[model samples]
Target: MEKRRIQIFDTSLRDGEQVPGCKLNAKEKVKIAKKLEELGVDVIEAGFPISSPGDYESVQEISKNISHTTVCALSRAMEKDIKIAGESLKYAKYPRIHTGIGTSNVHIRYKFNSTLDKIIDQSMEAVKYAKKFVEDVEFYAEDAGRTDNQFLSKICENVIKCGATVINIPDTTGCCLPEEYGKKIQFLMENVKGIHKVVISTHCHDDLGLSTANSLYGIINGAQQVECTINGIGERAGNTSLEEIVMIIKQNPHLNFFTNIKTQCFADISRLVSKYTGMKIPANKAIVGINAFSHSSGIHQDGVIKKKETYESINPKDVGVNDSSIILTARSGRAALKYRYQQIGYFLKKNSLDLVYSIFLKYADRKKEITDKDLETILEKANLIKNHSSRLSSDISRHVI
Candidate 1:
C-alpha cells in the first residue's frame, strides 16, 4: 500500500508562545520559525497578527524569511482581524490566512454572544474574506470536538464552498476522548459534501493528556494534517507535542502515514524551545526527555543490554539523541555489570562475572551507584585477574624448567 503524507502544521510560535510567561519577541519567533522550516514542517503558524503589533511583525518577518514552507497568520472571524491577518502574510511566497469562528454552543453563546446560525454565517464570511488575500485559506471550527457532528459537517461543507483549502477541526478544550474525536472526524468524512476537495486538519490540545492520541485517531479516520507544538506548550495543559506525533507516525509504518519531519532534529529543536520559553521538559516526558532512553531497573537493563528492542520500541538515535544509557545502580543485574565492565575494556568470563557481581552488590549497597573508577576498584579487589596472572606465571615457569 502507498503511504499517505501527513502535513505537519506547526503552531509552536503562535499557540506555544501563548503560555503566560513563555512569550517570545519577533526576533526570537523568527529564529524558531527558521528552525521549524529546517526541521521540515509543512506549515508554520507564525502568529495571530491582529492580536498585537509584536505578533503582526513576527508573522510578517517570518513570511519574509521563509520561502519554501507555507507561512500562516491566524485571525478571528471578524473582518478587521482577517484583514490584518492577510496583510501580515503579504510578503510570504506561500501564504495562508487562518480565520474561523467558534462552532460549539458553549462558544457560540458564551464566547461570541451569538447563535449557531450567526456563527456559521461568520465562518463562511471569514473564509471568503481571507480568500481575497491569499489562494490558501484555512477555516477552523473552534471547539468542533463538542459541536454537533451534523452541524459541524454543514459548517465544513459551507466553508469549503466559500473557498477554504483546509478545514481545521480543533479540540479547543481538549475535552473529548480518542473515540469521540475520531468519530467526529469520521462523521465529517462521511457527511461533508465535497470533502475530497479540501484537506481535513486536526488541532488538538493536551488538557486531558489525550491530544496526541486524539490527533492520531483523526488521522486514522481521515485527517491529513496535524497542528502541534514542539513540547506541547500552549493554553492550559498544552497542544500536542510535535515530536510525539511525528515519531508515532515514523514507528508505525503499518499505518502507512508519514511526514516530512527530520526526526533527528527533534531533540535539538525541543531543547531550543525549552530554553527560550523557560519551560522545563519533565524527566519522563516522552521522546526528548532526559530519562526517555535511560534504563535503571535490573530486568530492564538486562533486556536493553541484550537487545534494545526488548525494552525500547524507539531507538534513542532515531529522535536525535546520541544513544541510550545503562544506568548502574544497586538494582543493576549481572548483565549490566558485565556490560559496564566491557565498557572499560574488561571482558569478563561467565565464572569471573558471577564473582564480580557478588562483590558489586555489596559495594553498590554502600554507594548510590558504581562509576567506572569504582568498578575498576571492585574488579581489582575481586582477585580474579590476580589469580589468572598467577596461573599464567606458573605455567610459564613449568615450561621454562
Candidate 2:
C-alpha cells in the first residue's frame, strides 16, 4: 500500500514559547527555524504576529531565514491580526496565515457571546481576508473537540469556500477522548462540503495526556496535517509532541502514514528546544527523554544486553542516540553486573565473581546507582585479583612439582 504523507506543522516557536520562561528572542527563533527546516518540517508556525512587536519581528526574521519549509504566522479571526500576520511573512518563500475563531457552544456563549451563524460569518470573513495576503490560509475551529458536529461541519465548509487551504480542528482544552476526536474528524470528512479541496489538520492539547493519541486517531479518521511542538511544550499542559507523532507513524508501518521529518534529528532538536526553553524534557518522556533507552531492571537489562529488540522497540541510534544504556542499580542481576564490569575491563572467575557479587549487593544497597569507580573499589576491597593471581601461581608450582 502507498503511504500517505502526513504534513508536519511544527508550532514549537509559536505555541511552545507560550510556556512561561520559554520565550525566545528573534535570533533564537531564527536559529530554531533553520533547525526545523533541517529537521524536515513541512511548515513552521513562527509566531503570533499581532500578539506583540517582538513576536512580529521574530516571525519576520524566521520568514527571512527559512526557505524550504512554509513559514506561518498565527492570528485570531480579526482583520488587524490577519494583516499583521501577512505583513510579517512577506519575506517567506512560502507563507501561510493561520486564522480562526472559537467554535464550541461554551466558547460561543462565554467567550464571544455571539450566535453560531455570526461565528461562521466571522470565520469565513477571516479566511477570506487572510487569503488577500497569502494563497495558503489555514482556518482553525478552536475548541472544535467540544463543538457540535453539524455546526463544526458548517463553519469548515464556509471557510474552504473562502479560500482556506487547511482546516484545523483543535482540541483546545484537551478535553476529548481519542474515539470522540477521531469521530469528529470523520464527521467533517464525511459531511463538510468542499472538504476534499482543503487539507484537514489536527491541533491537539495534552491536558488529558491524550494529545498524541487524539492526533493519531485524527489521522486515522482523515486528517492529513498535524500541528505540534518540540518536546510538546505549549500553553497549559502543552500541545501534541512532534517527535511522538512522527515516531509513532514511522514505527507503525501497517498504518501506512509517513512524514518528511528526519528521524535522526529528533535528539538534537529535542535538546535544542529544552536548552532554549529552560524546560527540561522529562527523563521518562517517550522518545527523547534521558531514560528512554536506559535499562536498569535485572530482566530488562539482560534482555537488552542479549538482543536490543528484546526490550527496546525503537533503536536509540535510529533517533540519533549512540546506543542503549545499561544502568547499574541494586535491582540489576549477575548478567548486568558482568556486562558493566566487562565494559570497565574486569574479568572474574566463578568464585571471584561470587565474592564480588555478595559485596556488590551490600554496597549497592547504600546507593541508588553503582558507578564504575564504585565497582572497582568493591573489587579492590575484596582483593579478588590478588587472590586469583596467587591461586594461578600456586597451581603452576604444584604442577611443576
What digit string (tens of lDDT, one per residue) describes model 1 on residues 1-401? 89999999999999998988888989888889999999999999999998999999999999989979999999999899999999999999999998888899898889889987888888889888888999999999998988999889988999999999999999999999999999999999999999999999999999989999999999999999999999888888999999999999999999999999999999999999999989899989999999999898999999998899999999888889998988888999999988877776677777777888999999989998788878767766776445423432221121221
Clashing pairs in 1: none
Lowest lDDT 10-mer window, candidate 1? Answer: 392-401
Instruction: Show where candidate 1 strays beyond 4 Å.
Output: 349-359, 362-369, 376-401
Tell me the TM-score of model 2: 0.96
* Per-residue lDDT of candidate 2, residues 1-401 (tens digit): 89899999999999999988777999988988999999999999999999999999999999888878999999999999999999999999999999999999999999999999999899989999999999999999999999999999999988888899999999999999999999999999999899999999999999999999999999999999999999999999999999999999999999999999999999998999899889999999999999999998999999988999999999898899999999888899888888887776666656767888889999889999999888877776786444422433221121211
Q: What are the candidates' C-alpha RMSDs?
A: 4.6, 3.9
Candidate 1, lDDT over the whole model: 0.90
Angstrom error of the Cα, residue 286, model 2: value is 0.4
lDDT of each: 0.90, 0.91
lDDT of 2: 0.91
